[model samples]
Target: MPVARLSPATLSAVRVTLPGLGVIAVAVALSLAVNRLVPAVSPLTGAVVLGVLVGNLPVLPESARPGLKWATRRFLRAGVVLLGVQLSVAQVLQLGGGMLLVVLVTVLTTFFGTVLLGRLLGLPRGLTLMVSTGFSICGASAVAAVEGIVEREESEVATAVGLVTLFGSVSMLVLPLLADGVELGMWAGASVHEVAQVVAAASPAGAAAVAAAVVVKLSRVVLLAPLAAGLSIAERRRRPAAEGGRPPLIPLFVLGFLAMVVVRSTELFPEAWVPMTKDVTGLLLAGALFGLGSGVRVRSLAKTGPKALVLGLGSTLLVTLVAYTGVRLLG
Candidate 1:
C-alpha cells in the first residue's frame, strides 16, 4: 500500500481544527451530563450556554477557534441534513389539510411579521430574521440554519439563541398550568421554540399531549427548507451584483435535508438506524451550537442586546397568539 501523504496546508488545518473541535467535544459531554441530570435542559441548549461561558473567558487558546468554526459550518450542515430523518412527508400529511394549513400560516405570519416589527424597532434585519426563524420554526437549529444566509453579526446569533432559550423555557413552565392538556399540547407544539421545550411543556399533560405537540413541532421543522430557499432568494436580490458571488437559491444542505426526508418517507433505512441517526444528529448539533456560541462577546453586544431582547419578546408574543388562534380555529 502506498503511504498516505499529508500536505502542509492539510497538516496546518488538522492542527488548528482538532483543538477547537476537541474543546466542543468536552463541552458536549458536559452538556449531555446536564441534560441527563435535568431532562428539561436540552443538551443542545446546554451546549450553547457552556460555549458562551467558555468563550467569554479570557484564557481560551486561539488554536481552538478554527476547529470551533469548522464545527459551526460542517457539523451544522450535517445536523440539518439528518434533521430531516426525524420528519416524514407522511407525518405532515396525517395532520390533514387543515392542520397543515395551520403550520403553514403560523410560519408565514410569524416570519414576515417579525421582519416588520424589527424594521419598526430599527434593529438590524439579520438579527430580526434570525430571531424570526427561531421563534417561527424550530429554535437554535433553525436559528443556525439561516445564520449563514443572513450574514449577521455573531452576537446576533447568540442573541437569537438566548431569546429562544429564555422564551422557550418560560413557555415550558407556564403553558401546562393553563389547565387544558390536549388543546395546550397542539398549541404549545405549534408555538414553542425548541423540540425538547415542547415535550417538556406537554409531558405533564401525559402521552397524548406529548404526541400531539411533537407532531406539530416536527411539522414546523419541515418548513425550514422552504424558508431557507425564500431567504436565499431575498438575500440574492437585496445584494448588488458586484457585492460578491451570489448565494444559491436553495443551499446544498437544504437539498441534503430534502433527500433525507425522502429516505425517512420511503423507509429506505431500517428502523434500527433511526436511533443512531438521532444520537449522531444530536451530538453534531450540540457541538455546532457550542461552536457558534464561542464567537459571541457579551459586553460587545451590550448596545444591540436590549433592542434584540425587545424584538424577541414581541416575536414570541406574536407567534404564540397566532398559533393559539390557529389551534382554536382548527381544533
Candidate 2:
C-alpha cells in the first residue's frame, strides 16, 4: 500500500475554515430570530446588524476570522445564485413594453448617475458601486451581487446596506402618506430600494397599486444580470493588468441566476413549493449578509467620512426623481 502524504498547511486551512462556518451558522440563527420578532425588518438586515454587534462585542473570537471571510464571499455568491428562483422572464415581460421601458430607464440612470456622483464626491469606487446597486436594484441583494464582483471591504458593504435600509424604511412611512395613491404606487415601485419596502409603500394604495408596483419592481430586478455584466466589464477595464485581460460576459453566479429564472418560468416547482423556496433563499442571503456584517468595524466606517452618506442620499434622490418622471410619463 502506498503511503498517503498530507500537507500541514491544508490541515491548518481546514481547521480555520470550519470555525468560520460555525460563526456563519450562529449569525444565521440570530438573523432568523430578529426577523421573527420584527417582521418589518428583514432577516437580511437583521443579520448584518447582529453580525456587527457580534464583531464589536467579545462574542466573536479571532479564530473564526477565516470562516467569516469565507461566508462573506462564498455564501454571498451562493445566496445571489439562489435569488434567481424568485424571478421569471415571463413575469418581467408581462409588465408591458411601456412599463418595462420605465423600469429600464430608472435602473440604468440610477446606476450610472450614482457612479458619476461617487467620482465627483471622491468616494471609493467599490463603496460607491455597492450603494448604487443597493439603492438602484434590490437593496441588500443587489449589494451582495456587486460585492461579489468588486470585492470591497466588509465595512463598505455594511455602509451601503445600512444606507439602503435607512432610506427604504423611511419610504415605508413617507410614501403611504402621499395624497395620490397612484403616484405613491409609482414612486414606491420606482424608487424604494427593496421589494419589501416597495410593497409596504404601495400597499396603502390598495391591491391594484400593490400589484403594479411588484410587476415594475420585478422588471428592475431582471436587469441585475446585465448590470453585473456591465460592472464586470468596467472593472476589467479599470484594472486590466491586475485582473488579466478580458472578463467573462456574464459571471458564473449570474449565469446560475439566469438559469434559476428560466427554471422558475417553467413553473416546475408548483405553487405550494414557491413560498418554501423563497423562505430558504431568504435564510441563505440573511446568513451571508450577517457574515459580511461581522467583518465591519464601526470605527473604520466612520473614518471613511460623510461622503458615503452624501452619496447615498444623492442616489436616493436621483432614483426617486427619475422614477417619478418615468412613472408619470408611462404609468
Candidate 3:
C-alpha cells in the first residue's frame, strides 16, 4: 500500500483557497450576468444568492478553511466601511418632520410587532430578535450591532440574516411591479427594508417615487438609536440575570453613524468626494451581504421553508397596507 503523505501547511493553504475561489467565481459571474440581462434586479442581491448557494453546497476541505474565512471576513469589513460613506447628515434632515415621524412609526411598530409574531410562532428568542431588528432597522448592520448585546449563537444570526436578505431582495424585485399597478409610493417607502432595496424597487416608478422611497428609508435609519435603546432595555429586563444583571448599553455603531452624519453636515468633507463615498459605501454593503450569505447553510435555510416565506411576505404586505392607508389618510 502506498503511504499517504500530508503537509499541514500545504493542506491548510489548499483548504482555505478552494472554497474562497469557488464562491468568488460564482458570485461575480452571477452578479454580472444578472446585471446585464435583468438590469432591474440589483447585482448585490444576485451576489448574495450566489454566495449562499455556493457556501452551503458542501463542507470545504480542511486545508482551505483559513483562506475562506479570511476572504469572507475582509469582504464583510470592507462592505461595512463603505456603508459609512453614504451617511451625509444634511440630506437626512432635509426629509423634514413629517417624513421623520412616518419613519419612526414604521420602524417601531414593525420591530415590536415582528418580535411578538416571532415569539408566538415559537422561534428561538435570539433569532426572533435578530430578524425583527434586521427587518425594522438597517438590515444586516442592525443584526450585526445587536449581536454583541444579544449573544445569540452564530448559527441563529446566520439564519436570520439569510432570511432578511432573501425577503429584502424579493421586495426589491417585486415591489416596483406592484407599485406600477397600485401607485402606492408611500406604501412602498415604508415596506422596503434597506435604502438600496427601496431605491432598486422604486426605480421603475419614475423619479418621484424613487425620491420618496429614499427619503422614507433614510428617515427610518435615523430612528436606529431610539429603537436600539428600547430593544436594549427590553432585552435587559427579559434576561436581567443573564446580561450581567444590568441593562445592555445601546450599540456604539449607531452613535458612530450619527456622529458621522453630524460631521458631514458641518461641510467638513469636500463636495467632490461625496459621490465617491456613496459608491464605496454601496460596494461595502454588497461585500458584507456576500460575506453574510457565505456563512449561511442552504440546507438549514430550506428547513425554515414555507413558514419563513409566509411570515416575511405577510409582514411585508401588512406593513405596506398600513403605511399606504395611513399616509393616504394623513396626507
Candidate 4:
C-alpha cells in the first residue's frame, strides 16, 4: 500500500486558529449587538450565548479543533487572572460587622435550600449538591471544588454548571430591575452570584448598589473554606470505603484572589496601576468566557434545555423574592 499524507492546503485548513479567532470575534460582536438591542441584558451574558452557539454548531472544520482547544484554555486561564484584579481587601472589611453575618446566613440558606429543592424534584444527590453549591457560592470554582470530593460523573457536573450559567445569566438581568423597583440594595447583594455579574446588572441601580452587591458577593466567597471543609467531611462519611485519597485542598487561585485584594487595600500596587490591572483582568475573563462557551456541546445543552431553564428560572425567582423581602425588612 502506498503511503498517503495531508497536503499543505489540507494541513493549513485543519489548524484551529482561524475558527477559534473567528468565534471570539463573533462572540464579542454579538454581545455588543445584543446589548444595544436589548439594553437590559448584559454584554457578558450575550457573549456567552454567542460562544455556545458557535461552539456547538458545525460552524467550523475539524482541522481547527486543536486551535480552538488551545484558545479556550488560554481564555479560561486569563479570566481567572482578570478576576483577581477586581478584588480589594479593604472593601470586605468595610462591609461592617452585621453585614458579614447576613452574607454568611444567606449563603448557607441558599446552599441548603437549592439542594433540598433539587432532591424534592427527584434530582440525584450528587447533582443536587453540585448545582446548589455552584449557585450558592462562586460559579465555576464551586463546581470544581465539589467535584473533587463528590466523585459524581462529569456529565452531572456539566449539567449543574450549565444550569448555573443559564440561571446566573437570568439573574444578571432580572435582579437589577428588581433592585431598581424595590430599592433593595441589600437583597441584590445577598442574592447575586458572581461579583462582575452583580455589578453589571446593578449598574443601572447606581454606584451604591454596585458597591453593596460586590461586598455581599465577596462575603459569600469567604465561606468557601468552611463550606468545602464541611462537604469534604460529609463526603468521606458517605463513601466510607471509597478512599478518595485525601480530599483535594482548596485551590490556591482562590487564596491568591483574596491576597490580591489585601495587596490592593494595603497599597502594595500603586493607585496608577490599578486601572491597568483591571483592564488586564477583564481581557482575561473575556477570553475565559469565550473558551468556556466553545467547549460546550450544543446538543447536550439542548437535550437538557427545558430542565435547566426551569430550574434556573425558578431558583432565581425564589432567591429574589426571599432576598428582597429579607433585605427590605432588615435594611
Give the candidate number with the greatest lDDT. Answer: 1
Best of the candidates, TM-score:
1
Model 4, which residues run further than 4 Å from truth? Answer: 1-39, 124-130, 138-183, 194-197, 200-205, 221-247, 329-331
Candidate 1: residue pairs that collide: none
Q: Please list the residue runs of candidate 2 whose C-alpha ends up more than 4 Å from where it truly belongs after superposition.
A: 1-18, 179-183, 242-249
**Which segments of candidate 1 are over 4 A away from where they belong?**
1-9
TM-score list, all predictions: 0.95, 0.90, 0.75, 0.71
Best-first order by TM-score:
1, 2, 3, 4
- Report the lDDT tens digits of candidate 4 across residue range 1-331: 9999999887776663777666566666666677679754545555555556666787756755666666655654444434555556676778776666667666777788777677667766777777777777776546544655665644465566666666766777776655573254566667766555666667777777777776777666666656766787777667656664655444444455656666777767787887787656544445445555656676655655565556666566666666666566554
Choose 1 or 4, whichever is better by lDDT: 1
Model 3, span 216-243: residue lDDT tens = 6666666666666777777777775854
User: How accurate locally, in lDDT, is each candidate?
Assistant: 0.88, 0.82, 0.64, 0.63
Clashes of each: 0, 1, 10, 9
Model 2: per-residue Cα lDDT over 1-331, one tens digit each: 9998779998888888898788788778877787678766878898888888888888888898877787676777777887887787887887677778888889989998999999999888889898888888999999988886785777898888888988888777777776356667767887899988888889888887887788778778888888898888887777767666555657888898888888888958575776787887787788788888887898988866588878888898889888888877886
When summed lDDT is taken over every stretch of 10 residues in candidate 2, the lowest stretch is 240-249
**Of models 3 and 4, which has the larger TM-score?**
3
The window of 10 residues in a row where model 3 has the poorest summed lDDT is 76-85
TM-score of 2: 0.90
Angstrom error of the Cα, residue 129, model 4: value is: 4.8
- Tens digit per residue, CA lDDT, model 1, 275-321: 89999999999999898888888886677877887888888888888
